[model samples]
Target: MWASSARIYAVALKEIKQLSRDRVTFAMIVMIPLVQLILFGYAINTDARHIPAGVVDYTQNQTSRALILAIEATQAVNFQHHYYSPQEATDAIIRGDIKAVLILPHDLERRIALRSNRLTQDSARLLNEPIGQWLVDGSDTLIAATVRSLRTMPLNDVTQSALPQTPVTFEVVQWFNPEQRSVVNIVPGLLAIILTMTMILFTSAAIVREREQGNMEFLINTPIRPFELMLGKITPYVFAGLIQVSIILLVGHLLFSVPIRGGLLSLFGAALLFIFASLTLGLVISTIAKTQLQAMQLTVFILLPSILLSGFMFPYQAMPEPAQWIAEGLPATHFIRMVRAIVLREADFLVLQQDALWLVAFTLLGILLASVRFKKKLS
Candidate 1:
């Protein structure tokens, strides 16, 4: 019994020593939880605040200005632009410059006065009248909800105080997603997250695993160039990415009834570029990582920000400017924007040219970096 106990203790101590020596695994085990806790706790916000908003105050009266101030006071909207026309406000929303637009009707004051006077007899009629309009970029469900809640408060308060029993109404025109279905927004963005996570992990592990098993050394001695070798490794995963994309899209449509309102060809084209970018990014990570475990740790490090900062779970605009700048550099960010534009807004290739160009640039940059890193690591 003493001999068996000694052997068991020795094995346990040996395993602990091995774990200590594998610093990447040790660091990951210790740091991943801490990192996730900090990120999710501090960075992720479901209650959307300070949403960029444009106001088209046709009345331009004290009443309208006061109402705007009250809405801004709610801390939900940051009224940045005061446009002359509703067309300008709508254009801003479509351009992704603002999330919500408040249009004060020309007869807002007059209507309120008339409604308040007639409130005692026909309070229900007051609710039917369109006092103003709130044009929301409903593609983002959280922002829309926040804006809707905020916009109604001032109107509701004024109506209650003036009439004591009636409620005011505004036309909340949700531009892209009228129904405000969460699936319409989430399903498309999930494509970017899924592709980024799977492609990066697979390719990062592929190269590191080869190196770990001594196959990379054999390949290094072969006639294939480093760039070509990198391409060969990434090529197979592109098909795998496409397969995953198709499955997710099909499942999203069948299960969640998420609509693909845009052209399939354009979506596929953007997806192809994004997949190549993610795979090459993995190759770059692989070159830096000494082991599959290290590669995976680096992959998770990249993925967490991609999920958080890429506007996957939260509005990109809501994050601080520095975080937005970081998000702009991520392929997942551009991919999410492109996918949402395509799937929710039915945006065409012409409309999405800049996003496509960014994806192309990222893919090329990733390939270049991967090739350089692979050569340096090989030597």
Candidate 2:
């Protein structure tokens, strides 16, 4: 019996040693889940605030400005632009300059003073009224709710004994995501972050490790285009990422009970764009880095800002002006909005057209740049 036990112990020890020899296996056993848990916990916050907003005021009267001031008063939305036409405002949203557009119709001032004259009653009807057709990026319910809440403050009680004549009475109408549940806005963006950071990191180290082992030279000599090679490498990882998303969304749906308000096909399509964009960004990093360590360091640097500027942590509005500009530049910033619009608001393409376009542009630009830079590096 003693001899048998000793032999069994030796076999177990050898198996353990073999498992420990593979760094990936060891890390998977002891580190991956812990790190991911920390990430998921830290990243899954719901308090959305300070959304960037563009204003198009055909009613340039004091009442219009007052209404802008009213929306601004909540400190939830920053009025970043005052365009002459709604088209310009839409352009800003497409440029990723703002998360939503506030459009004041031609007689906005007159309509505010007396409820009878609304210029775009049809537009208002399309948005379900009172919100007056606010054109949001349609991504985040948190900001939508925040804006909605800010829009409908009680009218100044002129008869109140406290104060007889207040200088400004601002009336606001928030167009989308009226209830503003955190789950609605946060989940979609959360989906994007999970796909972006995890898929990129997983593939980043895979290629970098091959290079460290002297195998990537063979791959470099192949006739495959840089973009094609990168795409092939990321394809498997994207599939893995989709599985991860399925797990997360399942958890979100079953445990957290988050609803899927948007069309499933549209939501999945957006997710694919975000995944492609994130993977291309990782490929760009892999081209710049020589080792897995360097790739990891670079990924962390990118990940931090992606979380912060994407309006997942600080409200884009609450950040200082320069910070706001930087936040708008991040891809995650747009993804977060896309997720919110689809999951929380049940928004159609018209409401989200600008955001969808910008995301496509960003994805195409990233792939093109990565391919160019990667080819140059290899040559």
Candidate 3:
């Protein structure tokens, strides 16, 4: 029994020595938990604050100024840009400059004053009147819901002072997702995440597995060029990616009732480019990793940022500018925006042209980098 215990200790010590030699594995063991804690603790905020908002104060009177100040004081909204017209506000929202727009009417102050006097006389007559309009970009369900809550707090305070009993009413227009369904927002982004996670992990393992098993040495002796070999390995995965996209879209629609409001052809075309980009990114990771474990560790490193910064769980507008810039470089970020625009907004090819171009650029750049890293002879 003592000898058996000694043997077990020897094997355990051998494993510790092996683990110490594997720097990538050791780093993963130490860093993953720390990274997760920092990311989840600091980056994620359920109570989203300082939402970028464009204000169109047509009145520009004391009343409108007071209302804006009240909204800013709530710390829920930061009115960054003041627009002259509602059209300008709409343009800003469409350009992704702001999440919501507050359009106070020309007669906003007069209406509020009139409603104040009329509240003493008769409350029923002024019940249907609207004080202003709050146009919200509802692509992100969390932001939209938070914006609604934010708008309520200040409006309630203003109305209570003006008409103690009558509540102030705004024409709350939730664009894209009027019902503000969480599934509608989540399911589309899930497609981007599923594709990213699967493609990166699968492809990252490909070359590394071949190298580990000595098959890469055999392939290195072949007549095939490195770029050609890389392409061959990536081609099969492209179809697999499309299969994934199809299955996810079908399941999402059937189970969640998520709508595909846009053109199917356009959606599929953009998805193809994104899949190619993701697969090539995996290949690039494979080139850097000498072992399957290293491939997986690197894949996780990439995926953490993809999930956190790609606007999957949180709104990109709420992130700091540096994080936003990092997100812009990720294929998942562009793909998520494309998926949301296509599925939720019914956007056309023209609407998604910029995102498509970015995917194309990423695909090309990834392929170029992977080919440069890939060697004709085993390294």
Candidate 4:
């Protein structure tokens, strides 16, 4: 019995050793997840506010000033920079500097005065009130509506005057992805999707690949423990994941100019936790799958739900209570939020502890399930 046990232990040891030498697997494990984190964090943003606006006020009259004051007071929009000339404001909009531009014609005050004068002359005044034109960036519909509804009432007394010489005022505000660069937000989200998709998919496939080749039968017949087998399979991935991370970060910073606001230590810590959890999930899936096709199919099923329900593409808070609860349970949901906070907000550990704990729990649970199933599969 003692000799047989020793042989079993030796087999497990060899498997662990063999895993250390797989360079392709190692690179996949390390480099892929890191790239995803950088890409996803840059791409996803829900809390879009403070749009850039441009103003071109030809009126400059007291009536137009009142309208401008109303816009400034509403707090819905902010004038980032103003152009004295209408041509400059239009050019800025075309160049993507400003999302929306406000144009006040020279006759705006005169029109308002004319309408007011007409209203006073007859109780039922049939005067044409010239509608002011507000040019908005068609890209952000929400911001456009906000800019259009700055004020409803006219600023000056229309009954007393026919209208002023300078009647119109221009105010423009930029909306969603206001920096006007699509890559800034999309790149970060790509990092997350790539990391989760590639890492989980390949890791799940590795075990099935070995089994199909009959290598798993020889290793299992030798008496290697389930935990050891699982660890051996995952160890190579951990190293690969780290390498992929470095390359992605380098590319995002150098090529894309995506900023990394948080401390390297904190970001890496969060990444390790997420990777461990994700890899374990793959292991669990592999244990349940009888063939490589089955494993890939299962991964696809899990991937779609995780991506959709995880608040990656949409806001979890906006969903109904049932959907919200489902989102809360997904590891991707928390990871997405964690990566974004780290990159954008530079959140401290205290702020991110909840997500960290969740990832740890997920990894532990997955490891336990995979180990039990792995033992059965081998037996």
Q: Which structure among the candidates has the greatest TM-score? A: 3
**Residue 308 displacement (Å), model 3:** 2.8
Compute each candidate's TM-score over C-alphas: 0.86, 0.61, 0.87, 0.55
Clashing pairs in 2: 50-317, 138-341, 139-337, 139-340, 139-341
Question: Model 3 segments beyond 4 Å from truth?
Answer: 81-95, 118-124, 153-167, 320-325
Candidate 4: misplaced stretches above 4 Å?
A: 1-180, 376-379
Per-residue lDDT for 1-379 in model 1, tens only? 9999999999999999998988877887888888778667766677777898999988987778777777787788899999999888876666566888888888888777765666465544665677888999898998888877854443544543643544455778887888888888888999999998899999999988887787867786778987898899999999999999899899999999888888899888889989988998998898888888799898998898899989989987677676778889999999898888877777676677787898888878888888887862344
Q: Mind sharing the TM-score for model 4?
A: 0.55
lDDT of model 4 at position 67? 69
* Root-mean-square deviation of candidate 3: 3.1
* Alpha carbon lDDT of each predicted model: 0.82, 0.65, 0.82, 0.64
Candidate 2 CA-lDDT value: 0.65
Q: Candidate 1, clashing residue pairs?
A: none
Model 3 worst lDDT window (10 residues): 151-160
* lDDT, candidate 4, 280-304, per-residue tens: 9899988867677667766765676
Question: Regarding lDDT, does 3 or 4 come out ahead?
Answer: 3
